[model samples]
Target: MSEKQEHASAYWKENLKYLIILLTIWFVVSFGCGILFREALNEIRLGGFKLGFWFAQQGSIYVFVILIFVYVRLMNKLDKKYGFDE
Candidate 1:
């Protein structure tokens, strides 16, 4: 491949890697904590609510928002590394 094509490919690969990682985190927090590990997590309390319940109702959304910021930060760094930043 040409030099530019190689860089483009690498950038895309890195982006996909971050996407997969973030999605995995989302799934774990939303589904694992909310359903699979609910019983265990319920033993803990968060603001008078069970941890699992909180995760199901609110934590997942919070995590998603946090993930958005995380993704933006990561992409900024990635863009700089790849000379794609404005």
Candidate 2:
């Protein structure tokens, strides 16, 4: 492949890597904590609420929002690194 094509391919690969990692985290927190490990997590408390219940109702959404910011920051850096930033 040409230099430009190689660069673009590398950028896409890195982007997909980030996406997979972040989505995996999302899935683990949303599903694993919320369902699979809920009973175990419920043994703890968060702000007077059951940890698992909190995760089920609020924590995952909070995590998703935080992940959005994290993704934006990561992409901005990636874009700058790839000369795709303004």
Q: Rate the local accuracy (lDDT) of all candidates.
A: 0.98, 0.96
The alpha-carbon lDDT assigned to residue 43 of candidate 2 equals: 98
lDDT string, candidate 2, 19-77, tens digits: 99999999999999999999999999999999999999999999999999999999999
Clashing pairs in 1: none
Segments of candidate 1 deviating more than 4 angstroms: none
TM-score of 1: 0.97
Pairs of residues at least 3 apart in sequence or in different chains that clash in candidate 2: none
Error of 2 at 51 (Å): 0.6
> Mind giving the per-residue lDDT tens digits that candidate 1 earns over 1-86?
89999999999999999999999999999999999999999999999999999999999999999999999999999999999999
TM-score of each: 0.97, 0.96
